[model samples]
Target chain A: MSASAGSEQILHENTLYAEPVFHVGQFPITNSIISSWIVVLLVLVLAWSLRGKIKSVPRGLQNGLEMVFETFFGIFDSITGSRKRTLQFSPFVMAFFFFVLLNNWLGLFPGFGSIGQIVVEDGHKLFIPYLRGATADLNTTLALATIAVVVSHIAGVIAIGWWKYLNRFLNFKVLWEIPQKVIKEPTILLINPIKFFVGIIEIISELAKVASLSFRLFGNIFAGEVLLASMSAILAFGLPLPFMFLEVIVGLIQAIIFAILVLIYLHIATAAEEH
Target chain B: MESLVSIFHIDGKLFLAQLINFAIIFFVLYKFAFKPIAKIMQERTTTIEKSLDDAKAVAKKLAETGLEQTRVLNEAKKDALAIVEKANQAAEVNKQKLIEKTKLEVAAIMAGEKVKIAQEKEESLKEMKQEIAGLVILAVGKVIKEKMTDDKDKKLIAEIISR
Candidate 1:
């Protein structure tokens, strides 16, 4: 983090935002975006290779990929409790895991924070890395979270009827049940209102779900980046190695956590009833 | 809220770009990777199940065939024993009939020989009577010629009876 050989002092800060490494026309490509693009390319090439080499009896990379798929399916089966629904939801969820996991791991490479261009920002020489962790940035996590939630809702609508799915949020069916049941049971009137309010809270919880999903991943990865930066600042060699290993485990855990959470959401959304 | 946005530098274009990135990743993974692989795994599971079923069926048939073979073998042994028993019984009957026939033939020959012997005995007794008559006549003539005495006649009769 120090300047090179008697050059003027530079202030290096691990910014909360992903720094733009370049501009393509009006669109600025951030470091995290570049990292994600690399991840995408890697994933595509991997997919192509696996597609080429895939066999009924898997071998090599195809075998590894099959293991991942089978493990994801098992985790998904535990969550969804039905193979049909697990099959429906696991691919989308696994995509999130692979994306988050790869990005988080790629950030640990040497060039990520160290190799970059220096620019003057607010009159301080700023070191902008060309590639950062995609999940470490808020934008990527937020977008992924939003997609997961939106897709869950869509799955809910597709699984159950849209009318029933709507009642989960608005409690239209419960409100309709109130007038009929209030005469038979007086407690129904009070309980139904509470249930309606609970439905309203459920609406808020959906937003909370997105926030929690995005923030949890973003926080863990971004903190890892900052921790690695701090460790590098202290000693740069032996110190960062431990944290680097920790980040690797953290990266895999966070990815699995994100996927499981998405699967849980998918399960909840696609469930036949409120219970 | 504005300060928070500025701190994170949340950008719509960036969010859109990331979304776009995720979409492409999801598509490629779902289409080219996960879908096909999971399907193949499921197919593998199905194939294994089918093979297991076939093996079970073959084992069951083998057991059934073994049972059938045992049953047939037991029946054949029983039939063979029955045939041997029947042949033994027939031989015993044939042996009894032959013995009875031989016994009848021997009895017939013994009866004819007995009749012949009786006839011979009767003829011999007749011939001996004629000779005795002649001897008595000769003894009477001798007695007359010898000048008759009661004691002599008695002596002659005694001798003739003794002889």
Candidate 2:
């Protein structure tokens, strides 16, 4: 399988980052970006094909899609505890799930990491594949997590007024109420400051959510890719099959976990705070 | 931060591209898949509910009609029975009247026959007395040589017949 493009030998290694494939006006297009674009195109085409066929009675593909949607809706409802909230948050969460899932599964295909060009840099040959799993890249997962967390805050602001949503982090209302309560209940002097501190901690936790969300997805998918590469490098054929199947399951699980976390965040964000 | 960036190769342009990609997918899938499918499901649920209500209404109407039919049938049967009973009573009255009228006519005919028989017996007895008287007169005449007249013989015959 080793072919000579020049006097340099091709070196294939599982990199922690998505390699740049091409450049367009100072913007480098990475393999992960390509995979993401392919996922987007595939999803758009599937949706477009199923669009006109959606009927009230629902037959064939429509029937299967409706069942899947209903099941997912039920799962969202269980997290949000309200169907209205689930419906409001479903688009973003479902997009994240499908995009991540397709990227993970598509990365396991035959020619994804195997088919590439040999680039000679400083007399050292590097094999750069044309496609990589989008979730394996930290940039993609970070972007999705940023969107999820930011949208949750926006949804919170919309659901409960902006001032009320802001109180989740800053808690200025509790601090302001201390003077009023101090005369009636002197214990407010101690409890209100603690509550304000807790609100500060809440802000830290929100940041933690973004970090955890992005890192978890990136770590899982990246590790799966590394594992498959190592297994194939060891035996070149049969050894990677089991790991591929494991990656498939891991891909499905990570997608579900990411979607569920987003839904939970949405649910928590939109809920009215009890004073 | 530099080490992390260089190690992971986090690019701002790539992040933006991925975000745009996810946004496009979200809007398209929402418009083409979820929205229409949810709407159709809601419609199917409402249609099923409406059909169930219509079926319930039809069943109730059927039950009501069945009850009305049973009531009407029972009323007609009662009326028929009453009519039959009245006809039987009328027939019995007519039969009794006919029997009474026949008995009275039979008694009257027996009385008329008795009167006719008494009259005929009286006429026959008078004729027999007259013949006996004539015979006695003839015998007396033969013995006493016609001592009595015809008018006196006739009067004696009438007296003997009356006795």
Candidate 3:
């Protein structure tokens, strides 16, 4: 098939690219990044505007903000099982919630995907200009996952001293103790190997956390965006509206899941295994 | 044609992209949104707790004042009752003394009147005895005169005197 004569050949070249946003060297900025920035600015303005009016007797926006915190605190307390820890860790948890929530909701904005410049590549015109959902991008999700994992580890280190936390990954001392334990009880050797293997598996599980956290958020959000786009392309009118509302709910759920997962990671990290 | 699952496959580039994005978002949010909100919430909680403390202090003060007022009222009531009791006792003693004094004065006046009556009775008895003696002498003289004639009686009386 001649490139220009082919039926699949289109006016826009870059429109058909699977990933709409690309990187400038190391930085993987996308429509999601722009949206995230918008969200950040929005949050900053909202918080900054209402900074001084914190009242004991709830009034206006302060009341609303308090209710939100109380709710977050309550949920966090339930997860962490202590108000002290919730307060101790509330900053990270609440930040996760707001960021994830905003990023997910930003995808639902009108003209995010549809309103962008057309890029030409390989004699075909493509639509890749601006505005992709941050969560839809693997970069956003993976970055969040890394932060969640790394920060949680740091929290673990702080909560239970560094050596104990390091013991989670490497436990040669426990392995060395096996000979002495086996002398006392013949069954100790079998149990020791099992314990050793379990610790190894625990190490793998920590690596798995990155995969799980990133993919879960990316898949759900990306799938929702694709679903909306495809539905709108198919029906073009009334059919997409209801699904838009459904996507709103989905967006909220995905945001909640991401935040809760981060919170759970933090909770597990901070908890001492208690012998 | 590749399957739909192939499109969603995990890749290193995807992970890298997400890792960087997450870092940016986390930092941005930490600086702008989360930190400020957390601070506001903490400040708000402190404000509420302070108001509660102030309310408690005021309540304690009110309780103390109430107790003080009650104590003062009780003391005043006790003092009033004591004064009334003392006045009653003084009145009773004064009434008893007045009664005893009046009785003594009446007894003295009665005794003096009785003595005066006795003295008057004695004087009257003496006077009556003197009157009775004078009347007897006069009667005796009259009887002698009647017994004798006048001149002969007088001459016999003179001869007796000379003897």
Identify the candidate with maximal TM-score: 2
Q: State the DockQ of every prediction.
A: 0.65, 0.66, 0.19
lDDT by residue for model 1 (B7-102), tens:
998899999999999999999999888878888898999999999999999999999999999999999999999999999999999999999999
Interface RMSD for each predicted structure: 0.8, 1.0, 4.6
In order, what are the TM-scores of chain A for the candidates?
Answer: 0.95, 0.94, 0.88
Per residue, candidate 2 scores C-alpha lDDT tens digits across A1-275 of 33554545568888899999989988999998999899999988898789689888788878987887788999998888877877788877887888888888988888887777778777678999998888899999999999999999998999999998888889999999998889999999999999999999999999999999999999999999899888988998699998999999999999999999998998889888685
lDDT of 1 by residue, A1-275 (tens): 44562386666789899999888988989999998999999999998887756678888887888888888878788878888888888889999999989988998888887788888777667888888888889999999999999999999999998999999989888889998888889998888889999999999999999999999999999999999999999997698898999999999999999999999998889889754
Residue-level lDDT tens digits of model 2 in B2-58: 998999998888989988998998898888887888889878989999999999999
Fnat (0 to 1) per candidate: 0.84, 0.85, 0.32
lDDT of 3 by residue, A214-244 (tens): 7888788877877888888789789889988
Task: Report how far off residue A140 is in candidate 2 (Å).
Answer: 1.3
Which has the better lDDT: candidate 1, or candidate 3?
1
Clashes of each: 0, 0, 18
Provide a comma-separated list of chain B TM-scores, one per candidate. 0.71, 0.76, 0.55
Docking class of 1: medium
The C-alpha stretches of model 1 lying farther than 4 A from their native spots are: A1-6, A173-189, B113-163
